[model samples]
Target: MTTLSDLLSDPLPSGLGLSDRQWLVLSALPGMGARRLARLACECPVWPDGWLSRLPEQAASALRLWLDHPQRSPFGALFDGLDAWLTADPRNTLLHPDHPAWPALLAQLPDPPGVLWASGDLTALSLPTLAIVGSRRPSREGLHQAHRFGRELAERGWCVVSGLALGVDGAAQEAALNTRGRSIAVLGCGVDVIYPPRHATLYRRLLDEGGLLLSEHPPGTRARPAFFPRRNRIVTGVSLGVLVVEAAEKSGSLVSARLAIEQNRELFALPGSLNNPQARGCLNLIREGAVLTTCVDDILDELGHWAETPGTRSAAPAVPGSDDDDPMLGWLSDVPTPLDALVTLTGQDVTACQLQLLELELEGLATQAAGGWIRLPR
Candidate 1:
């Protein structure tokens, strides 16, 4: 029974060097997680050796206690298991912040993972990435929007990075792959452990399609609630920006959006009906200055890559819906006009006129404010 601790170990140092072996030892420390290791490394420029010698009394005591565990010790089975896992496949590779193959943006995270376990093409990480995330249970429209954005962005050569959760996240990444476009799935658990179980097929598909799957945790680790939010940081960390399609007022996606803003990465949110409970989180983001994205242009425009980029991969202005071209929509003015006024002005049945107004509203060309619907700048 190989445990995660063993999988993270590198006892014999056969194919491994001393530095990586030290890192594996650090990984095996029960209480010392990424942040503590990062802090220790920063506090002592010459990590591992120098830092271990001078570790504070309390920290050293904790490490000693962990070493006392029957299953953990001077690395025997742990290292053996690790070597086997590494040599099991050519795609299996582990990276740290110092590695040249590590994603540049990811290395900039406040507490970057010291060990990034991955499978598939590591170079694909160099391509600009856009993250798409939302609630695990999203509305139909939300799912549709996520897939549309994912496919479009991926087709334009941007890699779609997302937590491998269901609903919006899965929809987007799957759509990207369906189009034969590249994507990256950041796992909340080990790259080898399929948390959802149902996504077992999708998980293999991702790697089969040359998509990258990454995790900070070692193989054999199971998904935990805390791990998902922690995983969200990496999703946003590796992306140029994060696009939140739909989330509840108190959803985990909101946490990612805040992390993106804190990380100084661009934030984009898709607006939904005020009546939708799932859309409230995105609505709050829009209120607090996240760019409201209606199409790929909304994102590319904000990133300043739309019109100027030269290649087969640029987005064009969105085509206006035929409903927006109706004469009734032209009757709506920038000023708020009453429904009765609109009905009389358009000389149509109340329902017919309302339907047209709704069409224009969806197009971002009109909005109901003050007393009535008003024309809005597209």
Candidate 2:
């Protein structure tokens, strides 16, 4: 029986040289999980010789056999599959802990993937990244928030990361692509295998439009029930923070939120109406100290320090000096005005209106009340 583990074994291509080959073999060794591999890395063992002494008998034996007699190793077929998978696409590449291009943020995970199969532009990993994750079944409002944040984040030169699931994940990634911006879809299945089937177009567009596809599993591996939860770790692991658009009380997004907190990544949640079931998880997250995100500025305010690069969008926007400088201020009055009304009055999107309102409130020109926004004596 050719198992998924067997499919995980990779070929030691001459192009990769000896060091890369050792890392690949070690990662494919039986019983050599991420935590164990990470622990071994801490020892600073000298290549093959030092590593063999530290590896378990089973894994060490496998490595020794593979090194001396590659043709006799159990992983021969797996190596063939890996070689075939790489040759199948020029964009496809394997990433390991020692790879110079490996994401530093991902390395900080308690148990980072020992190897990653990736497709598309690896440079996306170098950009300032943020994550957007939420319910597979979400409210229309939740979906809107995802798109808004995704578009805004991408416009601000941020690489949006997500699981590329059906609802919020797809919406966010799609919006980012729509703007010709960068995004990385971290899949639970092989980078080549498109699960959920419905996202096939999205999966293709993600790569076609210059986004990256990442997976821990080898090519041809199928998505398992257990893989999705573990995939969330990588989703948050590579980003500065994660924005959960909406989630039910027991939604899988909470798992991501918890992972984000554990990873020490900033957590942001969009508040929804009390009546909506999908809002519960986000509300609970906010209660537990996640940032209550209402606009892109809210996130930028919190994570601005990470995006201070020269060519990227500034964390702070220029403040409007008067009503003439900002048209939104003209719409504000002593009475509370709803956000939608402000959007309608100012001819701007919800996110832009929210950002302007935030600036106004910061300058004491406006304030949010129970109903909506109110003008204050300046």
- Top model number, TM-score: 2
TM-score (all chains, Cα) for each model? 0.72, 0.77
Best by lDDT: 2
Kindly provide the TM-score of model 2 when superposed on the true structure, using C-alpha atoms: 0.77
The runs of at least 3 residues in candidate 2 whose Cα sits more than 4 Å from the true structure, single-residue gaps closed, are 1-18, 307-378
Local distance difference test values of all predictions, in order: 0.72, 0.78
Q: 225-282 in candidate 1: lDDT tens per residue?
A: 8898889889998777899999999998999999998777889999999999999999
- Predicted structure 1, TM vs. truth: 0.72
**Model 2: per-residue lDDT, tens digit, 34-53?**
88887776566776788899
Candidate 2: worst-modelled 10 consecutive residues by lDDT? 6-15
Q: Which 10 consecutive positions of candidate 1 have the poorest summed lDDT?
A: 6-15
